[model samples]
Structures are given as C-alpha cells and as structure tokens.
Target: MIDPVIIRTMKTVKEIRLENARALANEGPAEFARRIDSSTQQVNQFMGPSPTRNIGDKLARRIEAAFGKPEGWLDVEHITGSDDASISGTRSAVLEKLLPEGSGNLVTWETPDDLEPDDERVWIDRYDYRYSAGNGVIQWEVRQKKALPFDIGFFKALGVRPQDCKLAQVHGRSMEPYLFNRDMMMICTAKTRVKDGLIYAVTFEDEPLVKQIFKEPEGALRLHSYNPEFPDKIIAADQLEGLQIAGEVVYRSGSGLAGGN
Candidate 1:
C-alpha cells in the first residue's frame, strides 16, 4: 500500500502546482511536462485529482528549484480531515489528530488571502518570442507583448529597477531541472556585468540563448547548463563582436507560472 504520509504530501503539493499551472499555461499537462523536461505521463502521475506517483525528496527538490521556490516548500505541515468544518473547528480537529484528544496547546494554520493589485502595481513587459535555454534560437524583434504586474517591494529587495525588467519565456531543455522549457524568466536589462554561474539572456548574431555564463581567462567565455547531456559551449574573446548580453535572469517560474509575488 502507498504510505499515508506520501499521499498527504503529494496531494497538497500537487494542489499547489495545479493552481499555479493554470495561470502559467492553458495547454495544461503537456506544457508543464515541456517546462520540466519530463514526459506528460510522468507529470500526470504526480498531479491531478488522483495522483498515482509518490513524490520523493529528490523530486520535491527538483520541483522547488524549477519553480524558484524555497527549499522544503513541498513539505509543509498538512492537516487531514473534512473541509466543511469551520476554520477554528478545523484547527481544533487537526490538533486533535496530531496530539492526544486533549493537548496542552493548539497551533493553527494561517492562510491569508492573496492581495489584489493596486493602482501602483508595477507591470513588466513580456514578449512572444521564446528564449532558448537549450541550443540557440533565432528570434526577431518583439512583435507581440503583454504586461505582467509585479510587486514593487520585490524589485526593491532585489535592487533592480522595475522599468528595466522584462519577463520572457524560456523554450528549451538545455537548462532542464533548473530553467525548464516555457518557464517565465525575469530579465534585468539595466546592467551587463557577467557573473560566473549566473544565468543570462544573450544573443549571438541576433539569435537568442539563455545560459549560465562563466568568464574564462584570456577573455574567453563558457556557457554551461544543469543537464550533463549537453556539452559546454565556448566562445573565444575574438568572437565577442557578435555576442550581446540582453539581460541577466533574476527570477524564473515554471512554464510562465507566476507564483512569485
């Protein structure tokens, strides 16, 4: 039989992912699978009303990383029972389930409602062209675009100017398990300083590519990925003429999912 703890955790995590996935893609499971580099069948096994797969610690970590969530986010404390109970009664029931019938103290979960956007909400432009995280992709100027609202506080904490930020969609498995395909990326265009191990949206002769940049000695540069199947690509300093750094990736969400505030 499947472990009860596994069932509880999987159910809760899948619920969270499903809620966010709707905002990310209208295509559903197939789009989600493309983002995580897993087959659609595997994604279904973990999600849906009746999940057939157990979510292990490894897979949990991968999911957290792919969606830019905090570690252990998938393992939050879950209280079992009926949904019809009042909020306070639900807490008491959960406490009863966890502790003895009469316990010393009771702890309740606080689920604050999401705040609605206000007049001062910041909106960053999102483009239609898919930025490649695998091999380079040829893309033209932004013919279509949309604006996504972001909390101004988030930008202040990152020290990034809101106007200089652009949200772009990633489109390749080259950065699988980290930056999955169809993931929405927050690119900071204010600066061009290359940092080792930091992801950047760059261009080679007008072709767009998203990769972690490492500056090598003698002015050479190396592009790296989380997947071992893809080899590192090196660009000599002399080839810098064709290279252009569009922006540095500051945040990522699975397949255009915007769980981040």
Candidate 2:
C-alpha cells in the first residue's frame, strides 16, 4: 500500500501542476506539454481530476526549466493574496521582467534620442529574404526591411548577442507545426557550428533552407524536416562543400509554434 504521506504529497504536486496550467492558459496544454518535454496525454493525465499518475522528479525539473522557474519550484505552493493590489503588483513585476522599460506605457518617440537610457532595447534587422523550409529558394538580394526592438535581457537569456541575430521569415510547409509558412525566425549567426537536433538556417547549392541538422559520421550531414511528409536530405562528405550553415534558429514566432526540446 502507498504511504498516506506519499499520497498527500502527490495530491499537492497535482494541485501545483493545475495552478501552473492555469498560469500558462494562454499557451494551451499542447504548448505547455511541449515546453515540459512531455506529451499532451501525459500532461492531461497528471493535471486531470483524480489523476492516476504523479509528476516525477525528472518531469518536475523539466517543467521548472522550461518555464524559467527556479529549481524545485513545483514542489511547493505559492500563495497569492486575494487583494487586488497584490495581484496587480504581481502582474506588473512579471511584465517588468519580460518587457523592456517604458513598454508598459507605450508612447510614440519621434527619434531614438527621445527614448530613455534605461529602455535596454536592442533593434534587430528584419531581412526581406525568405528561407525556404520546403524546396530551397535562392536569396536574390539581401535587404533590410525594418528593425524590430527586443528587450536586451531577452537576448542575454538566450545567450545570443543582439548584433549576431537576424530576423527572417520561413517559407515552406516542410518544417510545419514547429515552423509554419511565413513564420519569423531569429537566427543566431554566431552559432554556426552544427548541433544535432537543433534547427538551423542554411544555404545549400546557393539556395537558403531552414531545417534541423544532424552531423553524421565521416563528415556527412543530414537535413531533416519536421513534417514527416518531407523526407530527410543527406549530404555526403564530398557534397558538404555546397552546404553552408547560416546560423542556429534560436526563436520562432508564428501561430501554433511551440518551444522545442
């Protein structure tokens, strides 16, 4: 028989999971499951009424890491007061951490000089070139469309320098679900080294493509697509000369795109 203490602890963990689910309601269960490196079914089962499974130590750590929470954050309950001021303060604190200064109160600044020094915002160039995720496409010419502002802290958290990052749109169904058609991707040019299972923007035979790269033995490389409908492309050691890795895809913003493990 399971110990009563163990049962109570499991129940408390389940309750905490429920609270986290509520907090991440905007991302939905599927995204949350993806972030926690777990399947949707597992998330639903543990978060369900009268859950049959308990969140193990490994899964709890994954959840904390995925959500930017501290270690063992899920092991205890966080109490929030019923007062409106307390709730507002909590929300403000979250926003402050996630957003740049003065972002909470938006105002039109005629020039960069009008912005305050504490803004800590970095502008990333949004190139007009598209990286094909299906069949490769030639980048005729590189042109800067505009600069998008992002919090400097955000880049620091991702371990990417602001200047080394460039924004481009993904154009193909091959990388779908994770990278949909016209999804904006942030590529860290400094990280051109191939890391297995990580998605990258690359140039193959003068055509730019976005795909997950896997380094094989004998200096060969395999380009993989998220959509199973698209078969993986293998580049032999001899053919590697035609392949040029632009950068690692650090972030993607689009509909239904979730954080990958």
Candidate 3:
C-alpha cells in the first residue's frame, strides 16, 4: 500500500511547483516543458498535484533555471509568507521577491514604473490584424504594420520578450464594459495557456474574438463576456478545430495606444 503521509507531501510539493510554473510563465505543460527542454509527459507526471511523484534534484535545478529562480528555490518543503484572502499567497510572495517594487498585483499584470537604468528597450511590430470585439465587422489581415518601442523590464518581469507581443486594438462591445471599443490591448503571443477566467484573443470559426475562456469539467471551452447583455458561448472539445489563440491579453489601455517610452 502507498504511504498516505508521503502522498500528502508529494501533493503539497507538486502544488507549489505548479503554482510557481504558472506564475513564471502562465503557460501549458507542453510549452513550459519545451522552454525547460523537458518532455511534457515528464512535467505532467512529476508536477501533477494529485500524483505522489517526487521531483528529482536534477529536474528541480532545471525548473529553477528555466524560471530564472535562484538556486535551491525548489528545495524547500514548506513555504511561509503573508497570505491574502483574495489572492494567492504563494504567487504573491514568489513574485514579490522576483519583481521590483510596485509590481504587486499579478492578476492585473502590472509592471513597476521605476525600472532600472540597465533595462533595455526594443521596438516590436504591431501587425495589421484587426480582430473585432463586437461583431465580425473588421478585416483580419496583416496590413499597414508598424513597430513600437517598449521597455524590456515590462516583459522580463512577466518572463517574456517584447518580440513575443502584439499591439492590438479592441473594436466591439462584446467584451465591454471592461474592454471598450477602441481600447488598446497588449497581447502576449507566447503565453498561450487558456487559463480560467483570463482574457484572450482567439480566432473562433475564422472570426476573431476577445473573451474570457473557462475550461469546463467536461473539457469544453466556455467563452465568457464581461457584459451581462451578451450570453456565454460554449465550444465543445471536438469543435475546437481552427481555434487559433492569438494570445493572452496582458495589458489594456482605455485612454489610447501604448507609445514609446
């Protein structure tokens, strides 16, 4: 028989590992494993919270390196810190240590304003894909592209590169009153995981949509709308064909487009 105490410890450690992984990359197992140069099956099996599997020291070091964590970060058995009732305690503590001050709210994905002088800035391209947020009224084509420069600290804090982002504008009411029409959104093309309750830009049925996606227990995707006037749409697992997820909506600006800083 399996030891219950060992099983409990395994579950706790695995949960922490998963939490750190999500905080660092916000990616699915496959992409995370790829970034770590590991296999998806190994990551899933070793990191599954319910499984009583131990992460070897070698693999632990790999995870720490992949997440840009300090050595021995994954060796701890128990973590202690302030716990916010409304947010994740582990995530907050881990991020607090890694990110600069004023970058507290991870859910909102805000970066600190006082970035170090050594932080570099790079210009990235904004494609011509106008994904409609209301109805399918805009053309989804790559045209009239332009490049904008952004500070690297903003993306480094999120474990992403500026080149992995796209500058897009919201153009419909289906996503309002949160993301209004003509609002600017910084979409992270690399963060492809369909995490629950997070906003994403996806091409559904050859049409673009900006909505919150929730993975149902039965494996269907529930496209949710912030406005109560719009009904939630469901897409079965089998019907997920041609669903190209543009990326997670990291930042939004109701004022105007993000300019060079």
* lDDT (Cα, tens digit) per residue for candidate 2, span 112-146: 67767766889787874444433343342447655
Clashes of 2: 0
- Residue 228, model 2: lDDT of 99
Runs of candidate 2 with Cα error greater than 4 angstroms are: 1-118, 130-144
> How close is every model to the real structure, measured as TM-score?
0.52, 0.54, 0.47
Off by over 4 Å in 3: 1-119, 131-140, 255-261
Ranking of all candidate structures by their TM-score, best first: 2, 1, 3
lDDT of 1 by residue, 37-144 (tens): 787667755653345555677876776676676887656533244552254354445434644433433222232124443766786778744444333433334534
Please state the error at residue 147 of candidate 3 in Å. Answer: 2.7
User: In TM-score terms, which candidate is top?
Assistant: 2
**Model 2 accuracy (lDDT, Cα):** 0.73
TM-score result, candidate 3: 0.47
Query: Which candidate would rank higher by TM-score, 2 or 3?
Result: 2
